[model samples]
Target: MQSQPVLLTAGPRHELPVTWQLSGHARRLVSVAVAGLLIAVITRRPEFVGLAAPALLLLLPGRGRQPDHLGIEIATPAGQVTEGSQAAVGVRISGQGAGQVRLRLHPGNWISLAGESPGEDGWFNFRFVPGRWGARQLGTLEVVIFDRWRLAACRVLTSLPPVICYPEPARLGSLVVLSKLPARLGEHTSRRPGEGVEFAGVREFVPGDRQRRINWPATTRRGTLQLNTFTAERAQTTVILMDISVDVGAAGRSSADLAVRAAAGTAAAYLAARDRVGLISYGKHLRWIAPAAGRRQAERISYLIAAGAGPPYPLEMLGSLAGDILPPGALVIVFSPLLTLRLIESLRALRERGFAAVVVDVLTAQPGTGHGRYRATADLARRIWRMEQEAIRFSLREIGIPVVHWDGQSALDEPLAPFTRRQVVSR
Candidate 1:
């Protein structure tokens, strides 16, 4: 999605009192005045008093007045933003006799300003890219307003709205065509013969066959009438089941993060193919979007994908996903690290229920044994973990579920290429 500003600047808040203080420049002026007076007393120089008089006059009471009204507005976009994309945050200062506006912005994790600070016109036009996904606060904005003579200043703290950053789907130009399509109008060419543009095969000319479908070459070779048959174009349901049970790996490169990005890519590919796509974030709780198709559905799925970047959800026991949540004959594409046995059992349940499925392993690396006291113990435990992971993959394959490993270093298309060659077979 193209990036745009999604938030409006706030209006002036007169009720919020602004407490002004002597600015550093003002404090320096006082020191200058005191030094000049002391030098004049010691040397009896009248010219020193002349220099200190202006400094003392400027420091007199009521020389600098407090701002009558002060307001700070953040004009940055706050809605959905794509990961790795730059966002422009604009802060505007508005009020009568508003002092020189200076902002101290506290940037969030993986979020940094492109430049040093906001420009002279009270606009923070620097671009910042969010390294991670989810609803994240850009940071707190501390606005300091200074008087005309730079003698006094007041601070107004404003919390910037959390931006919902959406993970950009991988560049997947291909779609995984299902072996069987539901009996509904869509983009995929079904195996069943019906009305479509793609040719299925040649068949004996029937009474109801159209003359346009007649194959003259086949008829001439066989000395009998034959006609071309076309398969029906139909849509299928695709459910993206993501396992957020355990997140492994680094902050931005975690298994859960990779899975969310992959799921988004898969959903986009299927939805572009005119297939009904649904999402199920099976972790702390079952958050799902029923099978549907449209631009809105894409937005809904993207929003849900952003939610996966949050802190780990509380552990929830998994028995099995509800049957009603999954459409009959729907394709279940599981994006998981396969960290839990319960998730494996869930996939088993899916296969038993006759759902065609594929597992995209998002585990990028094995847990490492660092140079520590428990290095040997950790290595042994790592070996055990590898065995468990392999056993899980083997067991799933045994149950007719194809498990594909996505190391995240290469394009997802490489691992998913095999699925595109053939349709997923439901057990």
Candidate 2:
């Protein structure tokens, strides 16, 4: 997606209350100096007159001045940035007068910030680099205020609302097409005689054979009429099922990241191949899109994935969702790092219902060891965890389902290359 300003604000902004405070005991100094001066004059002693200097300056009217109305205008020129890219954040304080002003920006975990402090002119532009994916909101910005005397600070929380940070999809060119094709006109050759570019076997002239398909040479050689046949090219429907049950592995490089990236790439690749695509996201809730084809489908998939970057549903109705929306023989690709018996049952149900299904396993590596002093025990635990993961793989393979791992290091090759669709059996 092209990056644009997710938010922009300029011109006269609503003003914040202008509050002032005493600097270095200014009130005490002034009161003491005046009392001393009166005492000195009444007591006929001018020696204490020097004490009046500290109070006189502070007591002067308007010496510590404040702006009539403090206002801030923030403009995020590149308010929307792709993940792992940088943009500029522009901040201009309107009522910046005297003293010193510093922008106290609390950047979110999804961004790394660095920039020079705003000067007396109150204009600060900084580079904002986005880290992880999502429409992450920008952090809060607080303006630290210091009077001319350099004592007593008043923090004015300006109105620089959080803007969305768009996360770009990973580079996905193609997918290993192995699912069974339904009867439709598309790019994929069905290999049966219908309408397509590739030629199949030939036969003697049939009742419905077109004159253009007749092989003149073959007809003359055979001393009879002959006709040509070609395989039918058809589009396939691919459904991307995102299982946001949980995130695993390390922070920043978690399984959720891998799943989301892979899902996006897979959708893009399928769409490019002229395949009908749809999405079913199960993250705390089930959201779905029926089979469709077009640029709008890709955009909808991206938005759905970004919006569902959260925990999965507490219930186990993912199978129901799949059964309702998926047609027979549609390739169902599930992107997830989570595995449960309920999910396994769902997969079994899909296969039972004649759906072509595969699992894109997002968790590539093992989890980190726990923090403890029991070294031998930790080693044993790691071994057991690996065994459990191996069991999951074994079970999936038993059901004729292939689990492809996305390491997030390179493009995911044809995961379904070595696999075939399971034959549907009637109960």
Candidate 3:
């Protein structure tokens, strides 16, 4: 027995505005024509009344009905992608009476998708470019199917899959400039010790001595011992302290975005160098991720940066950070614009605590001209801004904490060179 094939489909839903029924240009035109025809009929012009009937019919709200049911299915690539890479996302729409519907996707910024009509089903494919790395809640797809004559418009909201875009990790060499600094702990020693690569001591070769570390010439000459020694490689912990304070003027760039990128870049570099990495973000509230090693730590930090914005919790929060955020004995790298007094105080406090704190200032190089009724006011503001920055730099230097100022215009590595040099010398 042959079986009939069943089709998978959805019904059309209506989203027409109530006023669309009798309160538009069409309605106005109908009222005018009806009045004119009634006047003619009173004037004994019966033929004119018949002519008006046709016009009245045209003015009546058209019989376009909303779709009975509607559904939108979105398709996207699995997992997260590095920044700048493109991902494919498709939306499939199905419903009865969807043929003449006009559909639009919301949040056109996040994903780039085009709308299409595939017979009874409407489909769209999007090429998404994630501006920054993190989990993004791409809101629902909005389908607006209107009645005939465009009088009434019906809207359908369908949930779409959420997408996460991970921050792009910079290459090792690109971030090596930052790593030129000596490891905070376990640095290689110049002189060889017991169980090391360099030749530390040569005694008569013990029976159990491995041939690999044996000095044959020494063994022959001394008739006693030969062995090589090497120092053990040490690992250090790097804590990236990001200032998310709204007061930190990023100039044109968003303070939050700049902080996130800096944290990501710095953390990735530390992890790649076999150093443990930790993150602490302070703004209105504090967010901390304990120090750890490996790719997973980097991922965890990236997720935090991506998902975070503005003040941490309380909206009215202000000032710099409290002392409880950082792990003891970790090298703290603070990335901030240093625009506020509170932030400066916080950095100073960290340095006081014996933490090797380095400040990466993300301030603007060019302060553009301001517009206002008072040129004097603009000039004063500029002067105040410059003075504040200089004071912050001076304060940090006095405390022996190096401040590497990064003007958003140039590569971070160049400005970081001096700090790296200092770190090497200090180590």
* RMSD of every prediction: 3.6, 5.7, 7.9
Q: Output the worst ten-in-a-row residue range by lDDT, candidate 1.
A: 310-319
Q: Which wins on TM-score, candidate 1 or candidate 2?
A: 1
Q: State candidate 1's TM-score.
A: 0.88
lDDT of 2: 0.69
> CA lDDT, every prediction?
0.79, 0.69, 0.60
Output the number of the lDDT-best candidate. 1
Give residue 418's lDDT in candidate 2 (0 to 100). 46
TM-score for predicted model 3 compared with the true structure: 0.68
Please identify model 2 stretches exceeding 4 Å from their true place: 1-15, 21-68, 73-80, 95-104, 114-125, 144-154, 163-168, 201-228, 309-314, 322-324, 367-373, 414-427
Candidate 2 per-residue lDDT over residues 252-291, each given as its tens digit: 6777777777777788888988888988776656777777
Model 2 residue pairs with clashes: 186-234, 186-235, 284-312, 284-313
Per-residue error for 358 in candidate 1, Å, reads 0.6
Compared with the true structure, the alpha-carbon lDDT of candidate 3 equals 0.60
RMSD of 1: 3.6
- lDDT winner between candidates 1 and 2: 1
